[model samples]
Target chain A: SAVISQKPSRDICQRGTSLTIQCQVDSQVTMMFWYRQQPGQSLTLIATANQGSEATYESGFVIDKFPISRPNLTFSTLTVSNMSPEDSSIYLCSVVLPKSGQGGLGGYTFGSGTRLTVV
Target chain B: GIQVEQSPPDLILQEGANSTLRCNFSDSVNNLQWFHQNPWGQLINLFYIPSGTKQNGRLSATTVATERYSLLYISSSQTTDSGVYFCAVLINAGNNRKLIWGLGTSLAVNP
Candidate 1:
């Protein structure tokens, strides 16, 4: 299994300010995913970031609001731009760990997550 | 877009009891996963079952890909097992694989 480290585990920001969350993996991975979870809600994927390409965002998300940077396989950054109170949520980074056998599919491992609060 | 639904939005059990959680998808999936989120908000991978069945200690999961549903079974429940369980699926759409998430089942095991 790969270990992931996320920074700014919890942050409080003004409505007009922005916050950037960083995810660092111990091993290089082919893809990294970002997800958000509002209070008492399910996890909603923000985007999937593949190395050497622009992130692919989900239907309700836009790159202008949630800009992502995948500089390399081991590191990625997700920035919530011009944040608002509605943007307050817990952001998480995830990756798939390949394993032998068991139908040749690996498990999904996630970071501790970054909890953002827009005041 | 594929729809994922989980049943028994909330569950309560006594220590040493058993429980089952279910996840249903609206379409075919290449990947089916079960995750547990603890009180501290850490997501832990419980099972990755696209098909067939798997067991890990007191936990086991069975997924019928053809039926588009999955079940997670936990035996001898403990207070430490109190948390939220989620089921997610990967729908391959035009060379891109997107994940659809379920609302999750919140479980509370009392001592």
Candidate 2:
């Protein structure tokens, strides 16, 4: 079980601006996931970042709008570009850990999440 | 793509009541999980019950993988249990593993 420290737990940004959210995991992991939870909506995966490779974005999401940087196994950053009021939502970072007693299997752990407010 | 459906979009109960939440998926999954999103928007993993049953304290979950469904039971609920409960199922796509999430069931417990 790894603990992820996510910075700037919350922020209020002006429209047309940009914001970069960072997640630092205490342990090394192969893949880090970025998700967006819009107001009163279920979580949506934005992209998956693996060290030394380009991030793979989900359908309806683009790399230019949500750029992801996975510089190392223990760190990653997600930047929301050209923000708008419709972008107001909570952003979360997640990593998978070896499931207890399951041997090779794993479970998901998430960062505390960043609450972004766009005006 | 996988589809997940959770029953009872919302629930309200007394502090000591008991309840059950159900999740149905359209396909076989590699794994299934239950999560609780607190008031502050912190997503907490409640269980990793891909099959069979597992219990932690007053919360228990069962995932009948063969039947493509899962159940979460909350006994003697507390106000602290009030939040959004979600069921997500993981599916393998080529070399990648992705989680398909349900809309979630919003719960409110009052004193």
What lDDT does each candidate get? 0.92, 0.94
Model 1, docking class: medium
User: Residue by residue across A19-39, what tens digits does model 1's lDDT show?
Assistant: 999999999999899999999
Q: What residue runs in model 2 are displaced by over 4 Å at the alpha carbon? A: A102-106
Model 1 TM-score, all chains together: 0.95
Candidate achieving the largest TM-score? 2
lDDT of 2 by residue, B27-91 (tens): 99999999999999998989988899988899999999999999999999999999999999999
Q: What is the DockQ of candidate 1?
A: 0.77
* Model 2 residue B111 lDDT score: 96
How many residue-pair clashes does candidate 2 contain? 0
- Listed for each candidate, the true contacts retained, as a fraction, are 0.89, 0.71
lDDT of 2 by residue, A1-119 (tens): 68999977999999999999999999999999999999999999999999999999999999899999999999999999999999999999999988756433358989999999999
Worst 10 residues of 1 chain A by lDDT: A99-108
The backbone clash count of each candidate, in order, is: 0, 0
